[model samples]
Target chain A: MNMLRRHWPWLLVLVILLAFPFLFYDWTKGRHSGFVLTLMSEIGVMAIFALSYNMLMGQAGLLSFGHAVLFGLGAYCAAHVVNMVKAGTIWLPTELIPLAGGLGGLFFGYVFGWLVTKQRATAFAMITMGLGELVSAAALMFMAFFGGEGGITIDRVMDTSLVGVRYTSPWQVYCLVLAWAFIAAALMRLQTQTALGKMANATRDNFERAQFVGYDPRMVRLMQFTLSGFFAGIGGGLYVLIYEIVTFDTVSAAKSANALLAVYIGGAGGFFGPILGTIVVVLLQSGVSLLSNAWLLYVGVLFIVMVMYAPGGLIGLIFMHLPIWRAGRMRELLLPYARAFPPALLVLLGFVFMVELASFTTIGAAQGKRFTIGGQLIDTTAPMPWVIAIAALVLGALWLRHEARGFRQRWDELMEGSKRAQATAAPKPQEAVA
Target chain B: MEVFVVSLLNGLVYGMLLFMLASGLTLILSMMGVLNFAHASAYMLGAYFAYTISQYIGFWPALIIAPVLCGLIGAGIEMWGLRRVHQNGHIAELLFTFGLALLIEKGVQMTWGLLPVPYRVPELLDFPLFKIYGTQFPAYRAFMLLISALMFGAIWLGLTRTRIGLVIQAALTHPDMASALGHNVPRIFTLVFAAGTALAGLAGVIGGNYQVTEPAMAFTMGPIVFVVVVFGGLGSLSGCFIASILMGLIQTFAVVFDVSLADLLAKFGFVVTSSTPFAEILTVTLPRIGALLPFLMMVLILVFRPRGLMGTRDT
Candidate 1:
């Protein structure tokens, strides 16, 4: 009980992770469906990638638009290692192959970081973008190394294992991935406590002040960037091990954007922000992509919304509610929630209809399909559906605005009451609920 | 010699096309401090719009209407989307633009399908305008050069001769100071963004048929345009012009002069037999790396001269 109380968060996380596969397996009736496991593995890899990105963006204040160079290099190098092992040149454990990727990433980071670290802010971003483009183009040009557009693929069933296991199972791979993810996360956590990490934060907060304090901001940024590259490389190596393919797309600007999206959407300030972001992003990617081809448009819209309304991210929004929730004021806001529900639902339904209408007009029209709505097949060729969708969108938006103002007003009143109650040292059950 | 002249003229045409795209991007980037990743997507949209419009209307009408539509889209994006994101800082704004680019590319694909749209040169401009020895120069290429030159002159005059242009020029160097001086910085940003996107759209209308108007066109042209902008520096139109020309010439001339390291070595009495490990590397020619040269130049320029050719700022 004492241990549980002391490390409750860690215990809770561990329990959830371990219990996930079993719960999913039960839900699917033990069909050997490995979708959740695969998704979790992807989350694990991307979590590391997003964390590494944050190490530069959040800590060093260096906005890198091309961090995928390290990740892709690591993947390519790992692919080569897999090939070498398959060729009987060396025998190594499957789990340790990602270390080769880390080494490859470290090597390139040192070289590229040397040149890139000289510039700051926008210059750094532009230079990194240039380097990224340079490498991706070179990857396509050099067919020997990059394998051109077709990309390079290696079989993971090498039959050589340190533990003498054939390593054929997805569950086995998942275990290895989880172990590495935990180790990487622990190391990253430890890194946050180091002097270099502190200096990185100092540089991010105010470079001029850090320089006045006798620390070179550029050096701090470079070191953080290189280390971030190393971790990203580890993720890349894991990527190859999971998918067994390395392509130019792996290191393209799009991949860098993916990391940026994950980190920003998750929240940059918190340590576990990237992990949360990776989970949300990977889930949305897998789930939404299956449902709609316009997943990217939705993602773009969501990102724009996040950038505008919620700069701190989903996690930040949750954290923002903590103080109010802890004061037992959340109970009082149930009335506002009830009042807000109809308008929110109407807005959501209207928005979904608009998106569907747009998708039907473009993608569905191309496929030569008609949209069915409310027990009637609607002709997508007609402008009536479009008119209705636009009307619904406008009306719903107006209603949502009105409801949102009311919700805000009610929330403010509850919060004021909660603050007053807190000041009087009331024995609030809200803290326990929180 | 004839091939050289043809290549030079071709390079000049391509260079001007690139300048049409890069100049607007450079201006927007320098003025707003936002590297709009969707700039090339706007170009792609322009091409698609022109192609669709030309199919119904005429080419000239399409050219005029498509760029105007692109400018409206740009203005709308800046006012509603980018303005909202600007508060989060540059990185967020950049990411927003990146997402916008992806969405635009996908949206273009969704609307136009995956195939390349057949946007052809007008009948009036389809014939050869001049000949160099046996090589002929198309009237379309000449038209492109003329339009780009006119645009360059107009931009130069607008910046130097007009009050708004002077304020924009000042913003290019000192955006904070311009804002402090009571200029409507936001309005200026929107105007610059709209103008930049219009230029990109114009490039698309001209260059679409010159190249290929495809879904993959944005990806192909986006990086190269970025390379030109970065290599040209942040706020210098002169640098942008020079870099665009340099990139175009390098890409064109490289394709014209197809010589490999192995060929050079062979001229020096060096021979390599078959089944050699280094033979593949030795066989790499400049022409084969045509797509990579501009980016290589960018990296070299960034490393050696961080401020670029005529850039006053570090970017």
Candidate 2:
């Protein structure tokens, strides 16, 4: 019963994940939003990738810029292995193809970790960046494995099937991805509870202390890094399985940045941070990018604000509200938040207007397209639009600041009251137990 | 010999430009431990600022005005942005700058369009200064060398001779000690950041004309500048200078040469064809891999030395 209680949350998550496609089956009228499945599958793959990356950045405090090298290599390996299976040379089941990718990731991780883990902090960042660039350059130059920019394509379906389920449909592939993504995420989360995980955190906090405790900090970093690479590779393998194509872009700096953005934005501080981050980022990448050319700008602004104000990310923001919610004082904060919302919306609209005007004036002009959104033309060259944008920005900002100050006062009061109540309420609980 | 001399001159120009950027970076990083990821974005801004200013007032005035504008902007970022993020620790500060770089890149794109600006050399200096082996060396190239040299002299004198320079040097190497000894370290940081950005702007004023000013230029040049800083060693200007020049020469010469590893292998009685194992990587030429050289040097230097060429401490 205790074990069931401890695992109920994970089991619930698993149930939701398993039912997701079926839930979509009704929404999409029996075909399962094949597009949605593809997108969700991509989210799953990126989630695993970001989680593994967090192992190095968050747990080990190693900021690596070239992590995609391992990821890409694993993908390439998986692709080759799939090709082998298709050729009937390997005779391996398609289900276990990710293992080949994981092994490949491990092999390269071991090699890279030897050289990279020796340096700490900033030097490590630079070196990894260089290594990433080096591999990318080589990836383009070398034609055999990387396939020279066009990348390697594979057929995930084969004569061999472990469960006799043909991997012909997007739903089937997605289910494969879901199962692997869940397994990978669960294993990585479990790893954090292990000795190696604790030691990794110890090394991150204080190198000398970990050393004093008889753990070689370098070895700890190396082991953690290698394992992280293994997970990243597994993610890559899934990428190959889902997309059936892996290219230089897989290992490119941009892709690595994607992982970084997800991990950091998700909150590298705790488990499931990457998962939340991956969902938001992938959603933004697929959804927001389709709407505007300035999606990156929005994401960048969000990241900067998070770094400046809330380093704990989205999950961190949720965690911060837990105490207030527990004390049943969450309602006090709602009105203030609602009051602040309009100004925030005004500011966002203003910023968007300015960006759209500027972009329309330049890039849109160059493209010979008018700045029209939903049949309304924005006369970007006119001064009125610019004036309106500036006014909205300035006025909204001032109003938001005033509103925020009011919220802060109320927040402090509620927090203090809760603290006082807890102080008085504490002994009664102990006395009741006695 | 002629190729060697021309390559040397070109290398020196490029290397000096890199040093101007890296010197400021080394000081800020060593002192604050915040690797300002947006440093290259500042350089990009400088070029754009100059480009816009030059259109209205001509290049000469833009040269003086753009850098000052960049300096002031840098000061604002330091005073408000970096200072606020500093309390969160270096990683947050670094990430803030990284985000700033992304935001600025978008801003630049929105303002300037996703195209190269029409920033060019003044026609007065566009004529060839001299010819070596039938190749014309532009007067602007000579002017670049002269300007960089003058800036170098100014910087050298400023750092070694001025009162503010001593405080800056002290603050750079030992921030806490300098702060404890009655110097305002944060102010020094703000000043250093402004000066660094101004130097970057100055480089942009000249470099924009030499290389096209575009949105992508920041990213293209950003990594190379970082490699120079690392290869030169952290907290050492002279080392940065040496590393920059060396990298510049290597890049210039690599471009000039058409030799490949295949030729070398053939000379050693090992013939390579398409069938040979890893033949593509083996046969790729130095010129083909020219872009990878600085990155390669960075990795090798970091792996072996870690402290860099003359760095007294590990970064």
Candidate 3:
């Protein structure tokens, strides 16, 4: 009962994930939506990748710009292993392909970790970036491992699944991805509670202090980096199975940036932050990208705003209200939040409207796409829409600012009340000592 | 001999262009402790702005106006965006600039579409300036060299000969001390950042027509400029100049020299086959590996000399 209570959220999430594909199922055709499955699988792979990235950025205070090297190498290894299995050179279970990737990632991670972990701070970042560029260039040049520009492709149907699963369908591959994502995330979560994890945090907070306490900060960073690489490689292995191809793009700086975006936007403070971030990022990449060409612009603006206003990310913002919720004063600020919502939405719509207008005039016009609203064709070369967009932006911004002041006041009052209530409710340290 | 002379001249021109971009980035990185990931975006903005302005006015007027416009935008970004994020920490500042880079790239695409602009050299500078063997060097390249040299001389004079330069130098070395000595450090930072971006804008104006003015230009040039700064050692202008010239020369000459490591190895009686490890690396021509050289140099430098060539402080 205790275990059930503690693990209810995970179980509930599993149930939802299992049921999600049925919503898009073509019952008459007896087929699932390929797009949804691919997107979800992408989310799973990217979540593991982002979690590994947080091991460095959040836990160990190491900012790497070349993490994709590990992931890409792992993928290449997995692809080779799949090819080997097909040639009857090795007899490995299909389920264990990701393990081969993990070993590859671990090997390269150790070698690269030794090179980069010598220095901490900015120098480490620069070295990793240089290494990333080198590897990416090599990926294009060398045909043996990276397979040149065409990359390495594999047929995932090796007919060697441990449980007799043929893995012919995207559905099967997605299930495998989900399983691996769960296992990797669980292992990583457990890793955060270990001595190395504690020492990594300690080193991140105060390297000098950690060193004074007889811990080698460099060793801690190297170990964390190597372990993170192991998980990232698993993600890469799953990527190969889903797409059946790994390209230089996997090892590119852009891929590394994707991991960074996931971790930063998710909330690096908590374990589940990267997972949440992966969902948002993948949704934006796959979903919003289909609707608007300015999706990247929106994501960029959101990232900047979050960095400035909410460094702790989406999860951090939720955690901020914990004190108020615990004190039972959360309802007091609800009205203020409601009041602020309209203008905020107005500002968002207005900004998006202007962006869409501009984009339509240039990129859309080139592609022969006309600006439209509710099936009504809007002229891109006209002045009226521009005027409307500008007016809405200005007015909505002003209104939002006005509401923001009220929201701030209420928020402060509730937070102060929460603090006072918590102080009174909890036993005092000084009294306990006496 | 002809190839050597021409490659050297071209390398010199390319090197000067790199210096123009690297100088600003070095100033921002050293003084502010912010890497300014958007530095190359500023260069890209310069190209786009010059292209648009040159469409109405001539290239000469756009050359002057575009950099000033970039300087103004830099000032606005510093005053509003960076200053707000300054309190959060250096990482926040870096992320802000990174986001700004993405925004600027998207904005450029939305406004200009996803095509290279036809920003060209003026008719007056279109003819050949010199002929080496059977090849003609365009007068525009000469003009670029002249402009860069003049700008370089002006920067040297401004930094060494002016009171404001002295103040900036002091602030760069010791911000808190400069503040204690009655200088507004933040204002100086804003000034330096704007000036640095303006320099990058100047490089973009000249290099855009020489190269191609495209959205991806920022991503392509940004890393190479970073390599220059890192290799030269952070905060050292002289080292940056040397690194830039060395990189430019190496790139030019590598293209000229079609030699391979395999050939050298064979001469030493150690012939390599197709199945050898890194066989592609051994047989690859110098020109094919030219793109990897800067990054290779940077990594080597960082590993062997963490402080860079002339770096006084640790990066």
Q: Between which residue pairs do clashes occur in model 3?
A: none
DockQ-derived CAPRI band for the predicted complex in model 3 = high
How good is the docking of model 1, as DockQ?
0.57
Candidate 2 docks at the CAPRI level of: high
What's the chain B TM-score of candidate 2? 0.98
Q: Between candidates 1 and 2, which one is better according to DockQ? A: 2
Question: For each candidate, what is the lDDT?
Answer: 0.85, 0.88, 0.91
Q: Which 10 consecutive positions of candidate 2 chain B have the poorest summed lDDT?
A: B23-32
Give the C-alpha lDDT of model 3: 0.91
Off by over 4 Å in 1: A1-6, A26-31, A159-164, A365-378, A413-434, B265-279
Residue-level lDDT of model 1, residues A164-226, one tens digit each, is: 666576667777778778778878888999999999999888889999999988888888888
DockQ-derived CAPRI band for the predicted complex in model 1: medium
Candidate 3 per-residue C-alpha lDDT over B56-172 given as tens digits, one digit per residue, 9 for 90 to 100: 988999899999999988998999999999998888898899899999999999989899989888888999987999899999999989998898888778878998887887776
The TM-scores, one per candidate, come to 0.93, 0.96, 0.98
Ranking by lDDT: 3, 2, 1
lDDT of 2 by residue, A1-434 (tens): 87786679988987888777776685545577777789888998999999999999999999989999999999999999999989878787778888789888998999999999988888889988999999999899888878998999998878587999778888888888888887898899999999999999999999999999999998998999899989999989989999999999889888888888898899989888989999999999998887777788888998998888888888898887776886898988999999999999999899888877887788778888788768988788889999999999999999999999998899888878877777777554343322
Candidate 1 per-residue lDDT, tens place, B207-268, comes to 89999999888888988898898888888999999999998999999997888888888998
Worst 10 residues of 1 chain B by lDDT: B272-281
